[model samples]
Target chain A: MIMLLNECKIEMIRIFRNPYFVFWSLLMPIIFYFIFTKVVDTGVDDQELWNKHFLMSIAVFSVMGSAIMTLGIRVVQERSEGWTTWIKVTPLPSSSYFIAKMVGQSAVHVFSIIVIFIAGIILNGVSMTFVEWVSSAAWILIASFPFLALGVLVGTMKRVDTASGISNIIYLALAITGGLWMPMEILPKTIQLIGSWLPAYHYGNGAWGIIRGQFPEFKSIAILTVYLLLFMVLSIYIRRKQEAV
Target chain B: METIVEINNLTKEFKGKRAVEDVSFSIKPGEVVAILGPNGAGKSTAILMMLGLLHPTSGTVSLFNQKPQEQKVRERIGVMLQQVSIMDALKVKELLALFRSYYPTPLSMEEMIRLTGMQGSELNRRTDKLSGGQKRRVSFALAMAGNPDLVFFDEPTVGMDSTARKQFWEKVRQHANAGKTVLFSTHYLQEADDVATRILLFNEGKLVADGSPASIKQRLLKKAVSFKMDGHFPKEQFLAMEHISDVSEEKGRIVIQTEDTDRVLSSLFSIEMPISDIAIDKGRLEDAFEQLTVEQGVS
Candidate 1:
């Protein structure tokens, strides 16, 4: 357990030191939330409803980017650069490698969630009850797992250069199609149909439900669980197929 | 005496083609054994199997009488593979600390540096920010962090400068002095000859020769019987010998290539032919090793 913590400690340092996280994980989501809510479309009749709704959208956006881009691309880089092979020869158990990445990246996502939630409160004066705030934050944190599993799928790419591109596409597609960028009502029917199938849609909707005095739907939780299992099994299958030993 | 490594019939096949054939050897404690072979000689494949990175199609690799992947076995061994195996953004000290924490009984920072012959000043810099030579030194330091009982280095001197190369072998020698079993693979003939107590000469995917450096060098000396013949030479006589590999004529001299040059010379005296200006040319050791990899690679 001490060794695993040490691994997580180094992982945190590595993630924090990387300039990429600043752009994609932190600054981009917060800036995009402000632009979409305050600058781009501010003429909504129910401004408070819009503020609360967009807050969930951007919160889900932030965690999803961290899970797929930050966690996923780091895995690809580490594996391609020989860190994975190096660890195999060490006394550290193989399970610890994955667990450390999962735990460490989740911690960073927690920070992202808190920061974006703060942005919603201070910037838009969006108010929520304490219970609603805590429950929604908890929902977003737990809902981010499927996307983290998707990140591992990206890590299995044959080349790091291509992994970055593929992961970027996956993150953006889920964000836009899953109604995290805008509500599914504004999107065409075809996109809405596709968005509903994505875990991102249900994850964002689960957070939006808490503020409206509606707990998350059973179907949303079920869909998210299904995607989580799918991503994990797919990533494991691809990884096993690629590796010779 | 107990052996540190016991490999038996270790074979690895990539698809249908073999990368490592049925090769076997054992290493005792305090012996510096070199896996000497040319490129694609399966040295890295064998080492990978021994370290549990590769699976043999049919064989076993035992380190300290346990499976290579066992955690108990892993705790006692250190490996330095032939690649840029370092994490980026972490300072050298952080990387060292992180790797050291993986082992239960790790060497101190100062002791790791001392054993690696490093100056211990590069610890403050990030690993990716270091120069090539500095990165190699830090890697060497990481390999020694566990204060391992058995150290495995796969082509440890592949892309090193003269000073770095000399320092690496010097560090290996230092470890050998402390009774740590060292096993390294190298294509450089002189490296094996200078550093190894025992040499395992591999050709293709098979181990062709195994013995002390002196004895293997003697066998790999590559001798030939050459004579200046004024009349028609009896090439058929030398060609018929099972020991003679080649009989080629060059610049008015008939050269009879054989593993046993004395036999060629004795046969020449036994034949009723005028053989004058006879000389034995002991070719360079590299040529003999090259011959081993090509002519005797199979079986």
Candidate 2:
């Protein structure tokens, strides 16, 4: 556990030192939230609704950025550079590698969640029940695991350039179809149905539901859980094959 | 002495093309064997298989006479691959600490730094910021951290300059003298000549020759004899000497390519002319390797 945490902390330091994170992971989400909310205003008068919508969208963005972009790029680089092979040869267990990655992503998720929630409360004058805030933060952090596993799968499949491009596309697709960009209900019915099946849709909906003081249905949790499992299995299988080769 | 690594009929094929074909060798404790081969001669492929990074298409690899992939056996094996293996994001100290986690018992950071000759604020420097020689040395340090009984060092001194290379060899000798089994691969013949207890030549994924350097050199008994001779235009006499493969005269000197030193020396004794500055040299490892490789066309 100490090793895992140390690895995660080291990863966090790298993220903090990276100049790209300043614009992309930190400032970009808030900037995008403002631009999108202003350009498309749904006829909902309550300020709290806008706050909830904006907060959830930024939270999803944070999750996408951490799991898909940062994790994907780093993993691909590590693989190409033979860092993964060295670790495999070392006395370090493989489980520690994955656990460290997830722990790192978890740290990023927490930061993203807090930043988004605090922005909503301070700037948008959003009010949330104590239970709502705690539950929403918990769910946002938990949802990072599935996305992280999916990122690991994608990262292991392709080289760094392709992984970055594919992860970005996945992030945008999830953000758009899953109601982070626009409400899924507002889209065409077929698109809405497709959006419902997306993992990001379920994850975003789960977060939004928590912030609205509503109990999340098991279906959304089950969908994210299944997708997470599939990605985890796929990542493990690909990694093993890579090692064998 | 116990044999720590045994490879039996190991073969690896890539897309139906054999890279290593039925090559078998065993390494005993405290022995250092250098695998010598030209580029694309399957040295890297063989090393990869031995390190468990690549699986053999046929046959078996045993470490400590157990499966190579077995964790218990792997725990006693240390490897430094041909490529850079450190993460750029990690500081040197952090890197050491991280790698230290992999072994049940690893050398402490102080010992690792000392072994690699790194010290004084350099320990906390990020890996990417280090020079290539420093990085290679650090990689060497990591390879030694586990204190394994068997170690694989693949092209460990490639990027090093002469001074660093000498230092690296000293460290390698220290490892072997401490009773560790080391299998290192190098293209530099002299490096092998200086340290390797035995040298194995590989060509086209096959072990073409294996023996101590002296033994291998001895196999090519054709030594070169050059002498400045005076007072005789003895051309046919020298040419007719037994065991002399070739005779040539250039600028008052007679050069003989002969396998039998005694026969040639006796023949020269009969030449009553003054023999000045006579030099006889046995074949070198490089010459023998080139001759064998060329003869076999080990491409």
Candidate 3:
């Protein structure tokens, strides 16, 4: 247990020290929040509802961006550099290694969430009860789990150079198609259909639901859970294939 | 002496091509062994199998009488692979601390720094900022951090300068003196000749020669006599001489492979061959290595 915690601490230190991770996970989300909420008006009649909706969307986008892109790209780079192979020969358990990665990514996710939330409250004049804020934060954080698994899958299967492009494409695609950038009502019918099936759509909906004082649809929660399991299994399978090779 | 490692009839095939075949050897406690081989000679493959990073197609490897993958066995062995690159974002001290946490009992931080000759700000620098040789030293320090009973280093000194290489060997010697078993693989003949108590020569995925460096050299029993022969006396004549095993020409010089250098010389004198710049050398590990690998390649 102590060793696992030590590994987690080491990974946390690495993430914080990296400038790229800091820029993408903490700073970029706040920048995006300001641009969308303060600069680009949604043209909705209910300004309060529009503010809350955009807040949830950026929060989900921030958590997914950190969990999938930053964490996944780091894993791919580490594998290419042979650090993963070095760790495999050590007495550290494989479970501990992964848990450390997740914990480290989770720290970045939390930071990204706080930055986006602060941007919503201060710059956009968004208001919410303390419980609503807490619940929305909890749901957004939980929604990042599937992206974490997707990050591992990409990290295990792709090279460092290609992994970056692939992860970025996936991150942006999920955010845009899942209606985080615009409401599903405004998007084309085909895009809405595809977005409805995506894990990000469900994750965003879950957070937005909490802010609107209603429980998220059980179907969305279930589908996100299923996607998380599938990505987790795929990541493990690809990782095993890599080790065997 | 107790046996620290044992491998029996080990073979590894990749995509139906043999990388390591029918190889076996054992190491005794306190013995420093070197796996000497050229590229594609299966040195890394065998080491990987022995470390349980790769599964052997056939045979078994036992470290401390336990399977290599077992937690108990892994805890007692430290490994530095040839292709290892440490995490670039981590400071040297942080990396060492993380590696040390993996072992049940590790060397103290001060001892590791001292052994690897790391000092002052070197330990505080991020790994990505380090020079190639400095990174190699950090990897070496991580390998020894576990205070392992048996350590495996694959071409550990490849990027090190001469001075750093010497210091590294001194540290290995110190480890052996403390009754630990050290096994390293290298293509440098002099590295094996100078450091290893026993040498394992590998060729084409097979254990071609295994013994002390002197013993392997002695078994070949062939000295090289070379001279500039001004005119071509028939090469067939030299081949027919007594005590001469083979003859080859290099850079317009005739080199005779002879077991008895004196007899070959007297025969040459009798023939009145115009010979200048005469030099005779005793058999070296390089000659034995060449002869062994070449012989294996032939048949």
Candidate 4:
């Protein structure tokens, strides 16, 4: 327990200190929120509904960015730099290291959510009941699991540049198709079709559902769960394959 | 007495190419052993297998008479890999504390500092921001933090300057004196000769030689008997002798290359003319290392 906590403390510090985490997860989502709600004037007839929906979109966006970029890139860096090799020889078990990363990155995801949530309130004077606010945050945090798993897949990459490049591509694709930048109705049919299978789309939908006083769709929950397991299994399989050599 | 480490027929292959092949050795307690080899000579692979970082293709490694992966074995060892792989964004002190928490019995923070010669300000500074030498010191401290009974260092001084290098060996010697079994890998023959009680020389993924430093040098390196001749010398007589490999005059001195310098010296005394300033040169470890690796292809 002490070992896990110590590892977690360092992991949290490392994630929070990262400039990429700050720029992509916290700053970018807040920027996008303000641009859409305050300036871009997303051409929806029901502006109030759009405001609440957009707020949830960006909040989910914030956590997903942290989950993928921060977790993925740092793991790759550690692998290439040989920190993984050093730690293995210590008495610290691999499970402790893994749990620490999960817990620490989850904390970063929460921080990103709150920062973007505050930004949403400031941008449009958006008002909601305390339950709506808390539930939206909770939904986004829980929905970040699949993205975190995707980050693990990215972590298995051999080089940081490849991890960074692949993650950016996935991030942009997730944001665009998931309706975080625009409403799902505005996207092309093919993209929406692809988005339906992506955890990021369901991630935003769940948060948006919470803000609209509706339960997150059971289908969305199940799909995100499947993705989480899929990525987790993939990461394990690839890691084992790498080690078998 | 039990062996601290035992490897039987250990081998590792990457993509059908041999990285380590059918090699075996055991380590005893309180022995400072150097795994001396050129780069890509399977030094790191063997160490990784012993540390349980890399699985062997065939065979096994046991530490403290238990599998290397056993928690009981893990708690008794520390490692500093060839690469400087300390976690970035952590204070040096934080890393030490984190690694120390892994083992059941770890050195105190003050003791770690004293052992590695790390200062207070450096400890507080983040690891990524440290200079190369400082980072190595931090790595060394992390390796010692567990107060391990057995330690493995793979090319630990690759990037350190002279002072840091000197300090590193000093601390390593200190640990060895405390009766810890320390195994380090290096390409520097002089370092192996100077520090190790026993040297394991690897060539082309094979354990080419293993013995005391003196014995290895004596066995593989040629010695030279040289003298300033007092009169005309019978060079042909010396050259024709079975003990002498070559007899030539170098810088006005008769230099005789031979496997047995004592025999050459004895023969010199039998000469009619007296000799002055007689000297013998034991061949360098570099030659033996070169001889081993170059001859590996043919063997």
State the number of backbone clashes in model 4.
0
Q: What is the DockQ of candidate 2?
A: 0.57
Provide the TM-score for each candidate, comma-separated.
Answer: 0.88, 0.83, 0.87, 0.87
Q: Which stretches of candidate 1 lie over 4 Å from their true place?
A: B115-121, B228-288, B291-299
Candidate 3 lDDT by residue in tens digits, B169-285: 998899889999999998776678789999898878999899997765455456888998786657898888788878999888788888788988888899888889998977653
For A185-237, candidate 4 gives per-residue lDDT tens digits of 78999999999888888999988888889999999999999999999999999
Which residue pairs of candidate 3 clash?
none
lDDT, residue B5, candidate 4:
92
Q: Report the Cα lDDT for residue A195, model 1.
A: 90
The per-model lDDT (C-alpha) reads 0.85, 0.79, 0.84, 0.84
TM-score-better candidate, 2 vs 4: 4
What is the descending TM-score order? Answer: 1, 3, 4, 2
lDDT of 2 at B277: 94
Q: Give model 3's TM-score versus the native structure.
A: 0.87
lDDT of 1 by residue, B1-299 (tens): 66899999999999888999999999999999999888888999999999998889999999999999999988999888888668998988788788789887899978776654445465677788888777777888788888899999988876787777888889889888999999999877667888999999987899989999877876676678788887776678768867788899999999877777787777778775687999988764555366333222111
DockQ (Cα-based) per candidate? 0.73, 0.57, 0.71, 0.82
Clashing pairs in 1: none
User: Interface root-mean-square deviation for each candidate?
Assistant: 0.9, 2.0, 1.0, 1.1
User: Between candidates 1 and 4, which one is better according to TM-score?
Assistant: 1
The candidate, 2 or 4, that scores higher on lDDT is: 4
Docking class of 4: high
lDDT string for model 4 (B10-94, tens) is 9898889899988999999999999988888999999999998888999889999998888888899988888887888878777
